[model samples]
Target chain A: MARVVGSRLGVGLALSVVAVVIVALLSSSTRLAVALGLGVAVLGVGATLVSLPAVRRDHPVVTRALISVVVVDLAVVLTFRVSATSNSNVAIGAAMAIVLLGLSFLTGSSGQISLGNGAFMGVGAFTVGIWADHHATTPLVVVLVLATVAGALVGLVLGLPATRLRGPYLAGMTLAFAVAFGAILNVFSSWTGGDSGLQLPSAVVAPHWLASYFGPGASTLTTSSAWLADISIVVTGVALFLMANLFASRTGRAMRLVRDNDVAAELVGVSLPRARVVAFTVSAAYAALGGALWTLVNNAVSPSTYGFVLSITILSLVVIGGIGTIPGAIIGGIIYAFSAGAISWLTAHLGLNPQGNVASQLDGIIFGGLLVLTIVFAPMGIAGLVRHGWRRWRRG
Target chain B: MDSFLTSRNVSDLLGGVTSGVIYALVALSLVLIWRSTRMLNFAQGAMAVFATYIGFAILAPSTNYWVSMAVAILAGLVLGGVTERVLVRPLYGKPEINPIVAMVGLLLVLESIAAAIWSTSSRALATPFSIVDWQLNHKPVALSPFALYEIITSLVVMAIVAGLFQYTKLGLQLRAAALAPEVSRLLGVRVGRMLTVGWMLSTAVGAVTAVLVASNFFTGLTPSGMDGVFAFGFIAAAIGGLDSPVGAMVSGLALGVVFQFVGDYVNSNAIILVALAMLIVSLMVRPNGIFTRSAQRRV
Candidate 1:
């Protein structure tokens, strides 16, 4: 178990270092490259030392999780500070990570498959989009809260029937929900801004007060891109922390019991319906939060963005990240971010015309191939592979 | 003049039934596969679209609709058999939901591959029959020669399938294998082979539906051309009961007429909304499905 934890940390640290290197190489600024390179060197040394045979095995799961969160947060911030063009992509990936974490609880713990969280995310994005459009001065925090509430409310309503449905039936209902949500957005074009979608107000950086307290030079960090990245990291860290705690709770155990065997769970006095509903509601709220963050990052919300494709992609992420695990979700997010970035870089450097649709087609192919390959060969995902390798090494 | 006899109403009714036949074809395919394997082939639409594209490619060179349709059906049979053998065989005895995820993955991969090969733009396939509406009492109605052909083809296919299931030895073996795989295996029936055959037949049906519907119902051969049709077929099959082919046919046609009426009287965008509403309401009222005699807990 100790070796597993160490190897997990080592894997994460190596991924972060690779991400930093990629950002540094992609950026045009020499200063950014030097800073990122130095950070990578230090992180590399630290990770190596920790993974050494002499390292102590006294760290608890909570401590390991905290260390992961801090390392990932720093990596995200550094990546964002260096690359402006890819900031939105990184932020979206982080938001998706948070949503995947939420889904991991439901799918991993409760054994429910939801393809409708995209709609919940859409609701969250539109909540923020509508608010920012109508009242541009409203605080981001308030908007996020409202979005989360709206998501949870919708989730509760959706979860009612979901409690009875299982497997394909549940999938069918959620698929209908996603389809209906998209149609509703189009029908109520006056509010959702129709198929063209709604443009959000420019995302503001740190409020004037916060920036003033940080002194004059800190204002540079308040750029919309930088601020969005910072917000994404903070939200993701908090969500991961909460998710970890939830997974360790009694309710979480009940969820797992319900997932594994409903008959057995019922015999033990677990309220199956209530557990399923709570899981659905919480996951939906998380999806909404992710959606809200997405809007903040992109400064827009479109109905097309939260369609069946997005829903399937989220499912694929959870599966590819290792279902039901927080660390898996983070790794999934990082992989998503890097692959998207790499695809864009390849397209740009190859001088492929974006308008010709080659880039998007290639992106689709990669994601699809990855999804199929992962499901077939590595059902336990990247994290599972690492654990397997660690066990083998220890045995030797 | 009676309001019910209005030309517009009659036209809408005709159009609805016409499109409903197409939906029935796809629904029948879905029902066939579900009954045999107890798995929803989410990639059915993509597979059909792929076969249709292949047919379209043949059409461009040969300009022969019959030849192209035959080619498409054959391609669908092979593709379906290969997929079942390669991808789905390993997934036997896994959790019910795992197959759903795998099918979604297959859907994505197939759709992406189709897009890469054919390009994303919609391309029209030349139909043998005229797409123009036929004359009715000196007025143009919604019924076209092509529409009539599609309706006839669907009915014929369904009849053929029904006949096979009722009268053929192979069909009996298939049914027995689906119902009791272990028992069938003990009885010397090739259960695995039957499952593959089921996929092939179902996929061929889907391909036929795609070919029939593509020219008129959709713009043309695009990666997402069959998505809406797939959704409607799913709903129709669900309403009819996933196990009942006859039910799928009836519900699909009924849904077609209802959606046509909605499109005519209400907003066109509300069609999917109405379909979803129908699905939810049906599931709530009769979880076992409207046609099934036995209520099986699918979850």
Candidate 2:
């Protein structure tokens, strides 16, 4: 029997839509938050029951339904949590995960290496910063949409040329893009705030009713961060779901075919440049979304924050975490969020002063070392390695 | 238009000549690694920076320029060799992306190590010669003694590398090994060792260029100090010919002068944008190189 990937997608799309509607209608309520949490818990218990080997074989649809329910439920629940620190971290992780997913999708699935992922993120970040500063009344959803569109346009402009270019030439252009981003920020200093960069007019706040419902007397700062975290999670969940669909779609197969052999892809009626450009454009859009979310989370945008170093960092994260897998992208996000403190802690224990250069440098040292080691010894990355081990274990 | 070429402009052009050689040196270094390994060394800048840190460690206490220079070069030689042997060797015949990935990884590691050792703060290189501008006929010129040192040192290294490639038995073996490893092996070339040596010499020269470039600034030794140099050098290599040593030098020098004029006439900060534009146009018009003859390209 043909594995109907479309059925899974259809189920996923419907569940996500229903989830979005429920949130939209309720918009804000402690009751809704409690309901979402309890609902997910019940769904989880039922999923576990249905996931028994015999039941899993008989009704795989339940697994698909459970996954969508769990994903959407957790995304909602995360926003209602009151931990500002954790929310800030989650926001960072979500933004990074979004960027990594796009990079992993582009580089892993279609074999296009872009050193300018950070620049695209910058474009989105600055977009929101400028937009929020200029058009302070614009809704968050609208602003994010505009940012995504801006990214798509830039990606289209670059991706059109990328279709003509091959390996070294492509790398060179992307490299130039990353390097020149600072110049761009400088040249448009009037809008960009030049060296200092720009800040959003205010922290992204939850709707008044929602804020009041969740926090009658809570600090606005923590509530705003939680709101931003929820936005980030929801956006990431949507992006992840879309990517999952893309991976299973005919277009995904065409991309794989092109990556493996463009000639074969052409023989099979896939337009090579079109496929490449689609991947590039979509990836850029995803990166833009990540950047916009980050701007909201940080409430500030700077040229230095999204320079070549960040680009390289994003690439290393994706590579070390496992390039092709969703879980790997998540792992990359977790590492990016926590690796600094972990490395600094380790360095301090080794007698390096916490305030010194070695501690600051260890982050890059470990990131670089892991990137190299992964490429040389475990090219499939951590997630891939785990999957390989699991497969072997099952076979044994 | 009249304002474009004043006495100051003449001095600017003169200044370009001295500074151009630094870029030329960078290009020359890149060409060596490319020719030897048939792979672009993404870590070239990081390696150069690390070598300079090695030099700085000695120079800070001893205040001896030449001795530190020698130490830096030797350090580069060993660093390059170990990197090629341990990190890059296993990548042979693998996917092209693997080498790029590996080299980038090496780049990060080297840069991070330098940062850890020296911190990211810029340190003085302590040159013997004065960096003050030389004046001629009551007008300031760009050719300071240190600038002259920068020029002479870079050009000389470029000359030696170009000469070695053109007229030596060692160069021949290195070229043969890179171009036809199996055939060279049959010819008793010790192909792997040649690669290791090629990387060593290449990075040693890179170390020299890096020292020269860094000394141009009073406070230039930092982990990421070589980044801008590397970017332009890569641009220079691209325009010269990824494969040709002499081509890299000529184009690099020319690019430096061109960059200077642009910075002088246009926004200095926007020069990188100009570099990107030129790179795109050049890649479009003459992907093989503006200067070198056409050759088979892997990419």
Candidate 3:
């Protein structure tokens, strides 16, 4: 147990450092055509070096931790490079990755299902949008903090009733929340800008200070995007680290016990309602942070953006990544980003019209098929597959 | 007070009853599935819409509504059986959430396929009955010829379903299997096959509800045509008791009447909110539903 905890801490620190470095490298270079090639080589070497000690120690936990950190590092760099070169909306991908990570923590700790985190995310985005509209001078950090608080408040209200409901009843209630949230947004169109959404003001940045650290050629928009990505990575790393510690603590064990058997948990003196409420509130706060980051990155907020589809997509990410595991959520996010790109690429390459039925339905086909296949075949998800393969490789 | 009970209000009440019959049909289908499988079919609405689309295809070529309806019901049975055998059987007795998640995936896939094949555009389905309203004392009443057909057809189907459950041998087997699969299997009943039949019959009921609603009330048949109906049906089932068919029927009609009055007097956007509010209150007051026996415990 000590060794496991030590390895987790080491992995968390390594991930944070790598995230900061990637942000600096990506934000500094305008000639990403050259940076892309260099970044890949640097990442490959770094991965090799990180794995060498684990290989020598032959400690399973250490080896697993090292492998996960390396994979996350590789994904970040590759995704950044792809977005830089192709001009795709990598910010959305990054935001989604962060949200998925947060969701994994929430669902992992407590065995309850929430189909309304998207609504919480909307609350976060709208908080930022509305705040930015009125208070242009406030720093972005403050805005995010306020948004998170608002999200947590709403989550508390939702979570209160959630404690009493179980299974489909809980799911149905949350679904209603998502639907009603959309309607509320429509009804209060004047404040929320109705269906048209709200536009974010131009991001305030100190170019001279950034240039001194990141070299001289970085544009403001690129810098802003990179900065948001960096914050997302750092926040995700911190959240994962905290979650890892929490899972190893007494509270985490009790929550898991509650999830596995509520009656048993209650018999053991654990407060089921309190534990559930805390899990939900924290999860909602995490989703809100992701939403605030999304608003910063996208510079726009619309009610339509946080609908049922988004909620389902987030749920799919958690399930496909591997429920109750951080590594699984990261893997799920990576797959989600790549699969989305692949669908678009296939449509474009096949010369399918974007507005046509086939093109429009491709995403649902691929993701839905993948979801079903994952659950039916890999009940434990990508992380489970990896673990099984690792065991086999070791035996051989 | 006089204005509150005007002709418009009376018409709205009548319209609510007509629509309530459709809601009750959907609620009955949901209740049937839940009672047998202990799984809430999230894909119920999507499956119904798919069947309706299939019915539409047959109708387009033959212009025979009866044949289309019959074929659709048959297709629903096949779809339900295959889904149970292939997708649901593997996850039986696992965590309850597993099936729910799988059902959501199925919903997405089915809806996407329908959209791909039929496009997202809404098309008018042909109905045998006239849409024109009847006259009462020279003032046009809410009940049209199609509305009457809808009410009568739904009543007949409900009666048949109630009879099947109350008086038939197969129904007894189905109940035994649902209540205790292991015990039923020991008693020489094919529990697995009974569960599949339950799915088929329930899905066929859903198909009937979809066909009836689409032909007269909804008019515009699209991939997501039954989403609203599904939500209403879920609320109705919850109000009645997830385990009680009689409760589903009564709650569905009550919900329809309440929604109609709310829509007429209050804001239309508040309908879902009201339903959700009612659900919360009901669950708080009686977690097992108003109709359920107090001795029963829900997890």
Interface CA RMSD, all predictions: 2.1, 2.1, 1.7
Tens digit of lDDT per residue, candidate 3, span A1-396? 556545544554455455546555664454563365345545544544555554435554444444444444544454444444222345465556667766676667677777777888998999999999999888656887899899899888777766666678777667667656777787677779988889987774544455567556654234555545555554555555565656656888888888888888999999988888888887788788778877876788999889876777777777888877877877766676577678889999999998899899988866777777778888678898889899999999
A1-396 per-residue lDDT for model 1 (tens digits): 777756756664665557455543443345565466556655754664555443334444544454545455465546545557567667778888988988888887888888788888999999999888999998878989999999999898778866666778777678768756778787878889988899976755678775675456542355667667767877887788788778877999998999899888989999988999899999999999999999888888988999878887887888888877887888878776677778878889989886666666877677777777777788777878888899999999
TM-score of chain B of 1: 0.95
The number of clashing residue pairs in each candidate reads: 0, 0, 0
Query: What share of the reference contacts is kept in model 2?
Result: 0.57
Better of 2 and 3 by DockQ: 2
Better of 2 and 3 by lDDT: 2
Over A82-146, each residue of candidate 2 has an lDDT whose tens digit, in order, gives 45776787778878899998888887667777878999999999999999998888988899899
Candidate 3, which segments miss by more than 4 Å at Cα? A1-88, A203-216, A220-224, A348-351, B1-6, B58-62, B137-139, B295-299
Ranking by DockQ: 2, 3, 1
Off by over 4 Å in 1: A1-69, A76-81, A346-358, B1-8, B58-62, B296-299
* Residue pairs in collision within model 3: none
Which consecutive 10 residues in model 2 chain B have the weakest lDDT in total? B1-10
Model 2: per-residue Cα lDDT at residue B98: 72
Best model number under lDDT: 1
